[model samples]
Target: MSQEIRGHPQALIDAEKGTLDPLPGSLSHSKDVKPPPSDVLLSSKEKDALVTTTTQEVILSAKPTASSVPKSKRVVSRWTLWNLWFNTYRKFFTFTFGLNMIGLVLAASGHFPYGVKYSGTIVVANFNFAILMRNEVFGRFLYLFVNTCFAKWPPLWFRLGCTSVLQHLGGIHSGCALSGVIWLLFKVVNNFRKLNVTHDAVLVMGVITNLTVMISALSAFPWVRNTHHNVFERHHRFVGWLGLICTWVFVILGDTYDPVTRSWNLSGVDLIHHQDFWFTMGMTIFIALPWFFVREVPIDIELPSPKVAIIRFKRGMQQGLLGRISRSSIMEYHAFGIVSEGRHAKYHYMIAGVQGDFTRGLVQNPPKTIWTRELKFAGVSNTSTLYKRGIRICTGTGIGAALSTCLQSPDWYLIWIGSEQEKTFGPTISRLIHDNIEPERLTLWDSKARGGRPDTMKLLKEAYHYWDAEVVFITSNYIGNSEIMQGCKEAGIPCFGTLWDF
Candidate 1:
């Protein structure tokens, strides 16, 4: 998705028709996008000219840059550790997988110290580790603490480097999950080797869980999630829950009620009895806690146009609010950024940008009741606490993600780029922004008015210096987020953006 598909289809309309309020009246058009003819301006002409999608030579040469140097060669030559990590996500997963493989190799070869006799425990431990990493409560505390601390820390670049580590926590989630699966398989094989009595229940549960985990991992593959999102969501939700249930049965059976004895054991009820059981219980609680908050609440949706749906509802306290709205709570869940007036606000809003069948359905036929989780999960911009001052850069409906953080912190600045942003999102959002936000701190870029695609990298470079911004918060498409992040990294400026690696 173009991050803001809500406006993209509408961008081709006449510029004067777009009713963006905050632009300077004396606007001058740059090459593609126009800048406000005010103090907050685009970069110098030379800096603007230097920015291009194609190589430097392509813009200078009469022919394509590929004519002078093949596109493949040009790209490969520009590769660096900094660029590789910041520009793409594959490296993070690959690194995690590689580390897991190496650890397993070392363990099997007698170089690793952890005992093989407790392989089953190791599996449970890894599973617990994965669960903890993905837990919303744990994630909130961990991210907020680190971000707040880094915010106060004097070493700007060092704290930024530390903050960057936060983005890759998903690595631990992936590595531990994969490792748990492998350890689980080994555990199953060992169980089979020692089996003499009827372990039909244990074997069945083990096999089911193993297959479930493998399928869950495969379904989470980036390509699968992007291409067949519905399938990905179904498998992850249904298969994941099934895997946990089977795991519960397997762990209880394997640890307490041995098939050899086939007798009820009182020790199974002991809270402190076995480490595996406790870990399993912990994982189970982590899985169940969110469902406790799941309720189908009444929704008030405003479909301003065919492209966007402004969903309003009175949720619980808006603190750290981020929700998933789905037609069916169990079938497909999509995360949306929560926008409220403030912490004391009685209600919040969720902007559903038309991206898929579910979102399209939401716009075409608004639902009376939508599923939502009570506990507000953490978002990328939740780390805004880490910066002394920052700029929230967003595109399209992406403004939803950054809007709350900026409102909550007056020190922050917001620059939103979209085509007909004000009209497409409707008056409620515009009224909220106008009433609360000072005109000086907000910049609304109407792309239809401004010629075409925006050079956000240059815009970010200028904003960082102009606003005396210590950090930048970006909530846009992967490309926009990555490009701005990459620009920040290259300039030695601390920045945070959503990797969406999950």
Candidate 2:
């Protein structure tokens, strides 16, 4: 049993000094929705019964008081978020766009020359709506239905395997946006070439719309976004608004151009009937929906340390839900997971690690009120509904994202690795864990107390075996999260973690 995990060597060395207690006879079960008290450390005697039915060899902990934990065997890992497994949405859009291109070629041959100039813009706008403006009323309701419907039906492992791809929605947004830009480019060319001499009203609008679309698309490039987040947000928001407005001007002029009459027709219902008009309308609503819920809610801020800010909101978010709150409604919005008992819980809290401008402001100034978008839809943890049991792995501030799931359900196990979490995150979080979580199910590895980081992979492997977990969710930084996620994948275990595609 030899497994290789990032920084595992150091971690294993540190873990050698730690201890796991022996099993007590007869593990008891709790009936209350609330988790049993911290005293509920399940006995090690149930190890044989707890390990999953997977083919992987299960090694129970040795009986010695200070026995070294067994090493885990490694399996080859596969990429679930790339190529065929991941980006299926992107592929679908690409294939559709490709078909459109072939159709354009056929139309060029005068076989299907229907709705050339007007249709292309509509298609572009429609694709943009599919991704950019996803939070519309009907759209959100439909998603909620799908998310809820799937949760109660599919077998846990099977659903866990499938819902693991939930984060790929961003890829569709990326694909369709690029395709829309390309299609709009062609539409602009057609509009310019067929510039009605008698009614050249759309010529300037076409040029401006094409340029704006291109800027919006290019500014959203992954590298550009990663390097300059502010630029990405500004262009994606401001230029997107400008482009959307130009799209209205571009489309109306193109639609009104009567090819035979060679003149513009100003009509009411006809314009409304056009596909681009409805698509743009829907997109606008989706873009505006989040802002509608924007309110400056009272926030109680507690700084446990300079490294961490435990910010609690008076109005609780959905349990096991993650949300975004900003210093200003329009800017500096960052996504963080919420920790609350449930709907009945008095207040929910978000952990703001001193990362950037927004977080740094909250830590230093401790705002009395903060702006939040209250859309109680499926978050990353909503996918957790797919599994009957799983392990949540997080490091430092990542614990904020992982803790809520463990708190909400008895089946989930939490492995939180950080330096002095009790001191860093303060009594609020510590007491929450101590009060609600069973001690056996929660692993808090204090790097300072342990001399160094514990063997994360080993701890994960042991937890997976100990708890009969079907899947693993990681919420650490890029390197740590990916490393453990990849390790789980290689070990023939289904895994889910943060995907930074957005």
Candidate 3:
């Protein structure tokens, strides 16, 4: 009684100091103390406060250390010197070519005195003008509508109407008058060349003139200069080639000039006598020869090929100016590719739009499995065949269908969510997961997850960071809403999804 009483008093004192250790092997006294009954346990509020306090402690401990440093800036490459050299050489060649052409034009005309006087000035002006016009409003419009109706239509209509009005005014004979006027203008210009215009002098003048005009015109149209860079490049190339050809022709014609009259008289004696002219002509020929003889280098580029492709044809869409009920069809082609050293695979689609009767009403026919078989035949094997090629899939609705043929690919990390209607696809997905697919990689997002809607963007971002996804494949009947597409774009991710309408 004395020892028990003494121990009990010490234990009680130890408990008060929160240092009591229970005795071993007894329900009433053990090394590990049992938790109190539910009624005696801490209240919900107290439990929540304790959890909050613990979380705060953890966060404080995780704070950045004094030695931790901020991230450094990323460096990008710039080929400034190369670009400068390119621009300088390009401008020089372009200027020289233009000047040479104008000289030939002047020499072809017999007006030697006038041609000699203004040829150099005109070349400079023309060269500038050409450069300026490259970025002008009219030039941009022409470029954008090249090979289209816009370029062909308005000009044709205006010229036709003007011609008709002129014909009425001058009667049937007015056509002859118009022709005569044009011929006169041509003869006047040719007279300058006939009067012994120097080919070199004229060429120099023409190039300078073209560049001057081009620069001025382009300067006036700042918006065109800023926006249509591709258009400017094409125009520059075409103009350069045209100038080079014109220069060649001018040199040949200039060499045919008569020595006595100092004009392009085309007498046989003058051609034979002009050795200096021949040398110049040879130089022009040498420059022109390379352009015509150069061949296009062929390049082999591997492009994406679809397996189990799906096509959706939407009819009765309006198009063009005819108020016609235009038919539209969307061809969604899905395929799979292995990425990241066979550790991951991606499913992607190439969506194309087709219009008119040929593609119209095409969605009425049911999607056939023939496409899938064809892909298999064309050196693309299913998941059972090989590990590297990965799988191919296509999805559709109505007459539209989705097809997927697997290859020996790693299991994809798919966060699949669906309602009751999607039960039909459950078996197919299950089969995919069971066979060659990894369970941890698959995320099934059913209605039960977080009252539905489940912060898809947050989930996708997390997945992207954790899994390092290369491609995103989303299949849902809700293609009408554009939010999914918008989100994907915002995330800088490409999406493979079905399209019901154009």
lDDT, candidates in the order shown: 0.62, 0.60, 0.28
Candidate 3 has an lDDT of 0.28
Q: Count backbone overlaps in model 1.
A: 0
Kindly report which residue pairs in candidate 2 clash with one another. 23-44
Measured by C-alpha RMSD in angstroms, how accurate is candidate 3?
29.5
Model 2 alpha-carbon drift over 4 Å, by segment: 1-117, 136-143, 156-158, 196-198
Write candidate 3's Cα lDDT for 329-383 as tens digits.
Answer: 1121122221111213332121211122222222333222212101100101111
Encode model 1's per-residue lDDT on 189-294: one tens digit a residue: 7667767763677777878878977787677666666678677667766787778778777777777655557754647365257777778877777777666777
Model 1 CA lDDT for position 229? 68
Q: Report the lDDT tens digits of candidate 2 across residue range 1-502.
A: 0000010111111111111211010111222223222233344356323432221111122121222322443343455334323444455446655766776676556676574645554454645445442442443454456567776477775576456445444444554565566667666676666755525667777778878767766766656555675676677667777877887777777666677787667787678777777776656666666667778888899898787788887755555556667778787456677788777788899877776676788888888988876764345566676666788887777767777788888778887767666777787887778677665576666555444555567667877766778788777655566557667766677776665434
Decreasing TM-score order of the candidates: 2, 1, 3
Clashes of each: 0, 1, 64
Better of 1 and 2 by lDDT: 1
**Clash pairs (backbone) in predicted model 1:** none
Compared with the true structure, model 1 gives a TM-score of 0.78
Number of the predicted model whose lDDT against the real structure is largest: 1
* Candidate 1: stretches off by over 4 Å: 1-103, 110-114, 147-150, 195-201, 257-272, 315-321, 500-502
Whichever of 1 and 3 has more TM-score, that candidate is 1
Q: Candidate 2's C-alpha lDDT? A: 0.60
